[model samples]
Target: MMGERILPGSYFQYPPPGFPSVSPHRPSSIPTDLERVYIRGKGSVKDSVKEEKLKDKPGFEHLNEPLHVLVEAELPKDVINSRLDYVVAILENLLKPVDESLDNYKKQQLRELALLNGTLREESPRMSPTMSPSMSPFNGTGMKRANYFSQKPLI
Candidate 1:
């Protein structure tokens, strides 16, 4: 009895159903494609910086100056104004359709609301306090009652 093993009863029915097995070949380290690209880009940037440093040495000083000077050249005020006007026109053209559609949508919604209001009014006619005496507890009676807390004591 010392060596004998006690087996627990099976919880599932006989001929148990098989489940889909998980893949055994999982990667040891998850590789991120973006991280790899970023690292590669970082290395290229470092190399470019090193190249720029090499070009900045004593013999290559004159080569560092920009080939063209843009600050001295000035465009006419009319040309700048024309460009600004063109940009504004393009923006207006892009927004015109959207504005029209929004206006039309608002009009349609107002019409729908008006129709709904008309239907609701027709379904239940407006009733005055005089028309339904049973519904209103105070039917236009101006009589006032003394407040319980503010009542005067008998002398």
Candidate 2:
């Protein structure tokens, strides 16, 4: 029930580039996924997937798979992404000065998970000066460079 259509060929696709290929009607033509499936073939992603599984080895058939979008498609008016909801909780935990017994460690673990999952990234410490170079100066990082030969001041 999302307002926008997600994938191609659930309905007719309006690909301007592919129009040239499928324009002239043919008498003896078979629809291919690339050419016709994207143009005229109206098939649900779920049905296509179900057909694929039938060709799989016996006992390898998928049971009770969660198909996010397609065949037997009946979605409610509202959908909430639980992962995104959890992300809000993660941000709150990371931001607030939580001092409970395991709170700090829990936040640390959450931060690591967010970073590794590519859900979030560390913002640059020195935010771009709001005003200007002349009006306001940048808060340069204080991380001192370490080296065997010599040391360079970070800021």
Candidate 3:
């Protein structure tokens, strides 16, 4: 949770990394179908806005499995046992990533990375889909692209 800034459209594991390794949520117990998630937060389960958020619902969406994310400030033992799936861990990854400000250069770097990783939709294709993977854009020399981008700060 402390290494680098979580940029827009970047995928990260919840409870990012400074917390102790021995967490109650070890990523396996989470339910594949999140419809059974029970949230302890204020407000009804489905508000008008929630339905819209569900269209682009957050999760490993490429796999076609939508997850129901439950938010609870404090986990109640009785509530845990009542749900179809159990709460693996009690975590509160605050909205700090959304609030952080980034410079134009950093923003561009994130954009480029997103494009390379296919996270962000590309405005234009540099190469056609028909292009073979073996063929290099520059030449077929098998030269490795220099990557200077690192999420961790160099000390």
Candidate 4:
């Protein structure tokens, strides 16, 4: 026969009265029905001292469900870390655009291209008799024909 020792209730689960530091030995000022009807009268009064005192009591409206508990139960460490990073990234994105730093670079590149295209179009009309098919910058430039036609002014 395996004689196993049984643990006390206090060993596993601590009740309100068990934890003296948390549970108050004294009674609360939230009056009983008779006390409210007779002693306190019709109108209710706020007892700040009692309210503050009650807040320190055990089971003083402490939520059973905490976010950390859920996170620990459902998600692994790596998954949690990844999700945390993703949330941080999303928050950063919402606060600022995704391509914020690249905006200036993109704008500068666009400006440079516009200048190059403008110069090319301007120089296209001034082609002399010496300018051959190979000499033409527009010919076989690999740029789309539509881009040249759209930007190129009719002579």
Name the regions of candidate 2 deviating beyond 4 angstroms: 1-68, 71-114, 118-120, 129-155
The number of clashing residue pairs in each candidate reads 0, 0, 3, 0
Q: Would you list the rank order by lDDT, best first?
A: 3, 2, 4, 1
Residue-pair clash count for candidate 2? 0
Model 3 weakest lDDT span, ten residues long: 1-10
- Give Cα-based local distance difference scores for all models: 0.33, 0.35, 0.36, 0.34
Residue 67 Cα positional deviation in candidate 2, in Å, after optimal superposition: 12
Model 3 TM-score, all chains together: 0.18
Judging by TM-score, tell me the better candidate of 1 and 3.
3
Q: Candidate 2's residue-wise lDDT over 46-148, tens digit each?
A: 3667656553546433223322121122234453233233333433333344445545454555566687677977655564636444433233443345564
**Over 4 Å off in model 4, which ranges?**
1-74, 97-155
Return the TM-score for each candidate structure: 0.15, 0.18, 0.18, 0.17
- Per-residue accuracy of model 1 over 1-155 as CA lDDT, tens digit each: 01111111121113233311111131112122211101111112236666476555775442354321111112355454444344334323322333433454334444555675674232224346355554543434533565787877876
Per-residue lDDT tens digits for candidate 3, residues 19-52, read 2222122222233243232321222224646644
Write out the backbone clash pairs for model 1: none
Considering only N, C-alpha and C atoms within 3 Å, which residue pairs clash in candidate 3?
A: 1-16, 1-17, 34-68
